[model samples]
Target: MKYTSLFTVLLVLMTACGWSQNDKQNTKMNKLTDFEEYVILNKGTERPNTGLYNNHFEGGTYVCRKCEAPLYNSEDKFESHCGWPSFDDEINGAVKRKTDADGRRTEILCANCDAHLGHVFIGERLTAKNTRHCVNSVSMKFVPSLNGKEQKVVLAGGDFKGLQFFLAQIPGIVRTKAGFVGTGSEKPTYESVQSGEGNYVMAVEILYAPEKIAFDDVIRIFMEVHDPTTPNQQGTDMGSQYRSVIYYNTEAQKETAQEVIQELEAKDVKVTTTLEELPSFVEAAENYQDYYFRSAEGPKNHSYTKRF
Candidate 1:
């Protein structure tokens, strides 16, 4: 009878140990879901400050750590000063807000299971839309393959459309039309006519009609090619000789140009791109026309190659 009692106690102790191990494993598995899984299990690195600088991502919603409940979408994720994942808003019925344990602030939790996630703050001015939900990176997971992995930098000539077929073979370039409308002619005019003065004259003119290209595309291409980070110049050409300028027609074009300049400035570029709202432009003389083609074969045998 004593032997039987000893066996029973031994069996109970062994079962308890097994159960404890299983419980610990289950807890770990629960934590290793989504982006958090990548960070923890796969040893992935999370970008500092919730990876806000990595804005190329486009799809999927982030979910909770304790339970796989959906929380915030990619669109809602924006830059916040707090060094964690931040959401401008959360999906409806997905999260519950309650006072935190410290009793000093409100905290957010998984709505379905009441798992503690992070804190949500109101009335922050990071974006035009006001509100921020600061979340710990360990508390959430990003869905698989929804984020953008391909990174590309595009550079376009101002007159890409009229020369589309010619430009297509150049890698990383997509030919799109851009126009200088109203009274201005789509050609370069020789001004402050310094004959042997400036460094290489990069006289660029947009040849396509206005209907073909959007204003935004032009701004994007211009920003891509030249270092807007530099003020008032490009490459070796110094002074106003290689000055970047946008010649606009209507008031709308003017406004768009200003907005583009402002956006570039926000990206920390020291931009000195000149804006010329002009009445008209006169074409350059015929002798200087098609200069690039002629120069490609002769004494000025310098070929212009496209960089993707």
Candidate 2:
């Protein structure tokens, strides 16, 4: 009897310890919003056309909202038009499906944390795979891949003095430097560029993380800070040195920049922004760097008319 009691006590202690460890591990993730908890933890469904990513077709990875683990890829996504983000495939072993409580549908859950994703349906013939992982937008976060790359875009739109300051404040931007590029010369000085030594322009090189920031956002901010519609001028600053142009680092950036320009045009906003491959970057002289920030009058009184 004594031996049996001792064994039973040890079993109870072990079970409690295991439960505590599991609980700790589960709470290690970032805290979810109330709505996210309702859908991800309670298996609730979002209404059609209301989710953040239902129409999003960006080239990136879809990660679990609760754990940020890789769940799906953009290439696997298809236009199911089902009011939810639909994927024809998932990362291998990244998702698990189980017979739902209704017994008529299979519920899909994240394989890593078992957080509810949505449902999986087969035999749909939507794609070659004929499978769809119908997922909730709130259950996942779209991570733009930018092809596992980071790059710098040099944009010239007249005086970069004030615009460069505002662009640097945007999120996901790694750094911003006032520079001269596309001048054909290896190291064009401010004096040389302004004097038409090359295809000189007052530009800013914006280095950013592709995953955290979309190129579209970068272009949008560029439009906001300066007059893209004007030719070779922003406000009173004129000449080819102040022309509106984007020097993209990669083909992807060039495509994105053009697409954004087209989108703006569709909205009846005339965009005279030029898109081209990035040229050699020559950092501006020491006095030109952080001009607005270091000035005695401060950012409120600056050269650029608009400030973000």
Q: Pick the candidate with the highest lDDT.
A: 2
**Local accuracy of candidate 2 as per-residue lDDT tens digits, 1-308:** 00110000000000011211233255325455566677889898877755546655656688886776689988898889788889998999899999999999999998878889999999988889899999987687655644446677898887766667666555565556787876573577777776767776778887677676778777876776677888877776668888889898778888888887887788787788888787577778745554543332234312333312
Of candidate 1, the 10-residue stretch with the lowest lDDT total is 5-14
Could you list the CA RMSD of all candidates, in the order they appear?
24.8, 19.1
Question: After TM-score superposition, what is the CA distance of residue 235 in candidate 1 from its true location, in Å?
Answer: 42
Which candidate leads in TM-score?
2
- What would the per-residue lDDT of candidate 1 be over residues 1-308, giving only the tens digit for each residue? 00110000000000011111232234222423345445433334454432321221334567654455688787887756566667878899888899876798778876765556577888778876687887655555454231232221222222212122222212222122222222322243333322223232233343322332356545554555454444434444344434456666557877877887787778776766767665443334422322221121211211232211
Q: After the best TM-score superposition of candidate 2, give how far the Cα of residue 60 lies from its true spot, in angstroms.
A: 26
TM-score quality measure for candidate 2: 0.48
Model 2 clashing residue pairs (backbone): 158-242
Estimate the lDDT of model 1.
0.44
